[model samples]
Structure formats: C-alpha cells, structure tokens
Target: MRTHWLSSCLVLLITTLAVAQKNTQGISGQVLWKAGNFMPTIGTKASVPKAVPVVREVYIYALTNDKQVDAGEDAGFYQKVNSKLVRKVKTDKKGRFSVTLPVGYYSVFTKEEKGLYANLFDDAMNINPVQVQKRRWTKMDVVVDYQAVY
Candidate 1:
C-alpha cells in the first residue's frame, strides 16, 4: 500500500515537472560599424601598419534584470551554465559581427579600453531587445560608440 502510493506520487511529480518545462529559443544579432568601418580589400595584410583598428573580442551576455550570480553560485537555477573565456573575433571587413545567444533577456556590450579608447561598458551597456523563439530567429543590429558606459 505504501509502495503503491509512493510510486503514484512520484509519477505525479514527474508529470508536473514535465508540464512546467517550456522550450526556449535562441537569439542572434550582428554588430556593425556606422561611420568608421574597419575592413580592407583583397591582398591587404592582417595588420595595418599606420592605424590599429578596433581589434578585440566581442561578447554577448544574457542578463536577468542586471542581477546575476558570479563564480560562487551553486549549480542550480539562475546559474551560469556556459561561462568561459569567449574567444576574440574580429569584425568583418565592414566592421560587422554576428553572435548567437540562448533565449533570455540580455544586453550586448564590449570591454573597456584605455588611452584613446576607454571601457565602454563602464557607464552604460548598450541594451537591445532579446527574444528567442523555438522556430524563429530574433535579429538585432547594434551600433556601439567609442565612449558609452554600460
């Protein structure tokens, strides 16, 4: 009798959990340069001797209302599952890039720099709408300035 009741309860709990799960979509967007494009024509060397264009890794982070658990959080809900040192990708010949992020709320930003270039995400991070549907692709185009706080 007890075993029967326990099995029934377990099945009910499993069913409830399954029903509560929702399929989340992924979002992808591109970052393009507005005024100062940074690519070159064919036969151009990788590095330009005179001027060093914006050469750094750009990362897209998923956000939940500006509150997040860092490296000390437990491996549960609201945990950083895919946290790692994202590789640096250069912009296209036209200073454009694209990245795919999991479905959730997020804001796109770049790291800070010094001297002529300063950290952009310091004051305000460039924010945009993020919506990832199961069968649909949410496209966003972002333009980042030289000095903007995140």
Candidate 2:
C-alpha cells in the first residue's frame, strides 16, 4: 500500500512539473512606433524621430518564407500574408504584450491601417522570424515605422 501511494505521488509531481514548464515557455515583448517627418534641414538643428510605444494587435504566424508575403507599393507595408496565423495578442497601453506558444519558430507582425507590417527578415528571407524554446521565454520587439521617413 505504501509503495502504491509513493508511485501515485511521484506521478502527480511529474505531471505538475510538465504543466509548469509548458506554461512558462513562450514570448514577451513590446511594440514601438516611429512616425512623422524625419528629414533634417540644412540650417536647422537635426531633429531625429523618437520611437514611442504603441497599443495595437500583434499577430504570430508560422515561420513564414519570403514567398508567403505580398509587398505593398508603399514602403514597409504588406498587402497580404499567406502563412498560417498561430495566435494574436493585443498590447497594453504601454505597448507591452506576452503570449504563450509551443516550442517552435514563428513570424510576427503588427496590424496596420493599410494591411500588415513587419520590417525584419532573416538571411534566408524568413519574415520577422522568432524562435520559442522549451522552458524559456523569447524576448522580441516589433517596431512599426512604416509611416516614418528615414
């Protein structure tokens, strides 16, 4: 009877640990935006654009290849994303957000008035690629600067 009880307790402990580990693994980050005129005048002191936190919806999709996204005519805009969307989360007023996902690679984007926006790409052309590891939280920041002139 004692042996049976011990085995049951061990099983319960292992199950608890597995659940805890799964819950702790995912991604967290903030979204920032840069907008307005950035061009500097020759006689005036150069005023660079400062990035500010923006509250918006963040979309997570499967690791997307270059062919999965359609480029817009305007800079930094995407007309469409053909990849499968995994999840989406809204940022707080301060632009901070966190999400739980299984361990794997994902592509992230922000909803834009024109469509979707993402400014990053890997060497292999993966759009805004991020990796979530087991028992770890991957930190990533999405910068929305499509309306800003550089």
Q: Give all TM-scores, in the order shown.
A: 0.38, 0.77
Q: Write the per-residue lDDT of candidate 1 for residues 91-147, one digit (tens) a residue.
A: 555445554445555544444332111112323332333555554556655454443
Q: State which candidate has the highest TM-score.
A: 2
- Give the alpha-carbon lDDT of every model: 0.42, 0.89
Question: Looking at model 2, how many pairs of residues clash?
Answer: 0
Candidate whose lDDT is highest: 2
Estimate, for each residue in 1-150, the C-alpha lDDT of model 2 and write its tens digit. Answer: 999999999999999977885668888999999898877778878678788999999999999987888989876568888989999999999999999898999999899888788888899989899999988989998889877876
- Once fitted onto the true fold, the runs of candidate 2 whose alpha carbons sit more than 4 angstroms away are 1-23, 37-45
